[model samples]
Target: MQSTNLKFIFDHSAAAPGHQHDARVFSESLLCQRLEDGWRPLPQGVLLGDSGYAMRDFLQTPIPNPQTPAENRYNAAHKRTRSRIECAIGQLKNSWRCLSKLRVKDPAYAAEIIKAVIVLHNRRMDQNPEDLPAPEEEQEDQCPPEEMGTTEARAAGKQKQNELINFFVR
Candidate 1:
């Protein structure tokens, strides 16, 4: 996970095989397990996730079919905010060329390498505070449909999403 300033917040260093879907990797993460056990990593904010993730009150995703303008606006804003992580990853890869094509044969070794890169990347950012990149232009995105089936968590997330849509409308 990354902050709004493109700084890494949480990185599940356990390397999953590249073939695994991101959602699956996320599901198997300690963060996800903690979230399931009612751990609120942040006190007063929610995290934005893509459609591949299961909806939760603290993990918001885009509306699959936004009929109202407010809902559409919400989706647009969600996409813009979520794209920060993508930019951060791009920045990380650009800075550490080794990350672009990690050829480590051992997953454990690869995970260690990734963790080291993240630490070094953060250090570089700290040293070169002025190296922050300009925000990328917002590009139109087709919000993917939510994939997780109905559940109690999804119900609560839907309610929270409605509240956000209303807030945006006003």
Candidate 2:
């Protein structure tokens, strides 16, 4: 999901039993693969993701244990920016109670239902955003485990993050 616009760029549904890690699914996604293969250029800005997502040139994840004040500030700013997506998600689930406990018999149908909910949520945000409740404080479980990418990608991601940290610190 795009934080600035609160729009979903892509949505997919897979069997939960096998696809446990979000990074695994995201890494294998066509969009990520295309970007990695240089078939597509990255968008103008960096994307913020939780620890579960590996750091990449286009995606920035938080520093798990920030040692310096600058690093701490960067993590704070990153979290604040990334929280927009979390807010949108909370609103979506709250607006549609059915999403809380999806009792669909088929996984495909469940996917359809989720997509429909997202569409409806977006419409609601567009029409009557004031009515939606504020997003709750993020819970510990929301901070997923970190997943590292390839060595070269990790190095690039670190360099970019360092640049940002320096910018903020300055």
Candidate 3:
């Protein structure tokens, strides 16, 4: 996932059965789950997620069928922003050949390995940011099923998306 500073936050791993859609995993994540007061407020900024995740105040997604030029522009910008995270993912895979396929049978062990890779990726980038190779062109992955959020949250999200569209159009 991408952080507010447009950096990869963490990469989670799960077994085949537990490998649910991104939205499900995100919603159930410690950061996103219930907090001391309630759902964590996205004070930093909205996250750019693919269509698989539900639109919410903290998470913005493109309209399925953009009807206006403004909507189209918003989608374009949204995709560009989301691509950064995708590129990061690709870089991780490229840097660590072993990550392509974990031969380890234990899912827990595999997760540990992934965590280690994330740390190494960050460390390498920090030490020599220019050393990392550019992300290669890649085919878009199929959109995961949409995960609907609360009615109120959906409405709020739509409003936020519209605001962004207007900003982009201007």
Candidate 4:
């Protein structure tokens, strides 16, 4: 994961193979595990996730069918904010051509290479802050691959999302 400043916050590319589902990989990451264990990374902070991720108290996803202006506004804002990550990824790939096609045969070695590249990417951002790309307009909508399972945690997530919707309209 990356920050709004285009810095790598959590680079768990080694956590799962590239073929794994995005949500599954996220669910298996140590970061998610820590959050599930009631660890708060930041005070009153929430992460914006794409539809592929499950809605959680710490992570917010777009509403599937927005019924009100408030909900629509929330989705629009979410899309805007989430686009930063996408832009960051594009910047990373553009800056480091090697990442475009990894010839590294060993998975472990490739993971190490990715980590090194991410570190270098962050350092480059620090040295040349102006190199960052301007935020782009909303791209294509990311529809959820399947219905996110419903549980008590999901219910809590919905509650958190509603709170955000209210905040937007207010």
User: Considering only N, C-alpha and C atoms within 3 Å, which residue pairs clash in candidate 2?
Assistant: none
Encode model 3's per-residue lDDT on 99-161: one tens digit a residue: 877778777787778788878888887788677777776666467645555788778878878
TM-score-wise, the better of 1 and 4 is 4
lDDT (tens digit, per residue) of candidate 2 on 48-127: 77888878777788998999999999999998887787777777777788987887677677777878877787777688
Candidate with best TM-score: 4
Clashes of 2: 0
What is candidate 1's lDDT per residue for 1-170, written digit by digit as tens?
Answer: 78777778654645886666556677678887777677886755777877766777878888877999999999999988888777777778777889868987888898889888888888888899467555444443334444554488788878888888998898
Q: Which structure is stronger by TM-score: 3 or 4?
A: 4
Per-candidate TM-score against the hidden true structure:
0.85, 0.82, 0.81, 0.87
Collision count for each candidate, in order = 0, 0, 0, 0
The parts of candidate 4 lying over 4 Å away from their true place are 132-150
Q: Rate the local accuracy (lDDT) of all candidates.
A: 0.76, 0.72, 0.71, 0.78
Quick one: RMSD of model 3? 3.0
Specify the poorest-scoring 10-residue window by lDDT in model 2: 10-19
Show model 1 residue runs off by greater than 4 Å.
132-150
Q: Estimate the lDDT of model 2.
A: 0.72
Q: Which ten residues in a row have the lowest lDDT in candidate 1?
A: 136-145
lDDT-superior candidate, 2 or 3: 2
